[model samples]
Target: MSRLALAIPLLLLALSAHAEIVIGLVANRGVEETRLDWQPIADDLGQLLNQPARVVAVKNEAELLASFQRGEIDVLRGSSKVALSAVEGGKGEIFARLALTGRQTQYRSLLLVRRDGPASLDTLLAHRQQYRYASGNPDSTAGYLIPQYHAFVRNNVLPERFFRSVTVGNAEDNFRALVERRVDVAVSNTDDLPKLAEKYPRDYQQLRVLWQSPPFSYDPLVIRRELPAATRSRIASFFLDYGRNGPDATRAKEKLYWADQLDGFLPATNRQLREVTDLQLYDALFRLALMPELDTSQRQSREKLLYRRYDQLTALLGGAR
Candidate 1:
């Protein structure tokens, strides 16, 4: 056999392997539309790279973060909280950040009560003795942390003193708790309530937005660092170009919020780690102090856990080896 013939076949095999890269997409809660309406984005992405794109629905932020650490996912459409964590861990790269609009492109923490109940934050505060409080998750920014921060951390309304009881769960669960009278006041985000209402009109009709918080930052999409630079850039370009409109133009129009549905992702400048830094600082100053620790080891473990994320982000972004 000729050496040239053998080399040609070997090169063809290598090219075949290169062409079949499977892009893993991790889905968290917010992109509910993406899971239901996958065709346009997936097809567009597939057409762009000429490779198969698979969307994997992840249940929560923890699962999404875990998958990124194990190198199981190639791209993530996630919350600011989770994306920033991925950025800090060095497991992913930030190609573009999502910009959500409404009262300054920021989301507010809302405190909701039953439709027939007291109508104000102070009213809820005074009646804390008579009602239970439910928050999305302890670690959730809009659902639990921010609301509690304002109510307890800033306003001197302690969790124990404000509510007769407290529960932590998913966003849906928080709303459910309020509707079913499981809790009197449920803390959640204003941006999320619309979708929740759209899904369950009856239940939603019974609740009202009692209080809203100041605008916080929007979420960003995190791409796994191991992906080829070309692929990363292409994905970013695809989103920048068609994320707001084109394929599922009508639905995409509804989803992207700017005046003309032109609200698309914008690239991060300065590679800022501000969100993660602020969160850690807040977690330490507030959340940590609120916890009842069983041992000093747990505290150290907590620090290491957060640092591990930072190390991963640093390594992936080329800041760390």
Candidate 2:
């Protein structure tokens, strides 16, 4: 009886260790594209963990958050802002950061305007209401937050109130709208610079960068904290070693598979998220300051909450490097 009891507990523990993993992805290039691009990686990860793994591709910030809230997602690989929220809301932690093959580990936000419509940033800003805008997901560091803070709010312009209209989508869609002349300005990023050149060469030529925000680290892989620490360490080791040295004879070249995304990953911690977090906090404070409709009492109360969260972020992550 005692032996059977011990074996039952062991069986339960082993089965729990192999719990199915749901990896969350943001379909930045559309759901099909995102899945096609990531399925190989997910398959490989499941192989390594010896566990069944699946992916859930989300199209926007809200969907991503909802998946995390429902406990349906066990992992994430996306924007730093999204990672920040994941680390907070999902009780997850950063495990690895994707290394861009030949590029800097950090990328900057880009504000693009049609070459013929608005000649320059100043022209767009000066005649803001005359032009429509296309932006990235609000939770995306490059798309909505950085440009809003750098070009709009700091200059006393609020996008929704200043532009003739503002539309939101992934970078590719927003760029498409820009090329089709549906929107006058689109916020893109350095990471997509090469992609723009290749996929939309003609349209790429017709577009010009209006502004660039400060640098931000690349997307990170965040996993829920309930995973075993040993498993997390093994996963980190897998990424850190995956793309280095050269292609393996047994597998296809990472360059061929991931394009610019997989140069291998650098093991990371939550500290790497601080820079974007700083922007997120300051952006809130600045936007609050610029809100025309915020009465003194509401402003004060919101400001108090924002600052409290700001302080908590600072305390938890330390100040940005």
Give the number of the best model, judged by TM-score: 2
What would the TM-scores of all predictions be?
0.73, 0.89
Clashing pairs in 2: none
Task: Give the Cα-based TM-score of candidate 1 against the true structure.
Answer: 0.73
Cα lDDT tens digits for candidate 2, 245-308: 3345226346324634556677788888887777777778877887779899999999899888
* Residue 300, candidate 1: alpha-carbon lDDT: 69
What does candidate 1's lDDT look like per residue over 70-89, in tens digits? 87777776565666667666
The true-versus-predicted C-alpha distance at residue 183 of model 2, in Å, is: 0.6
What's model 2's TM-score?
0.89
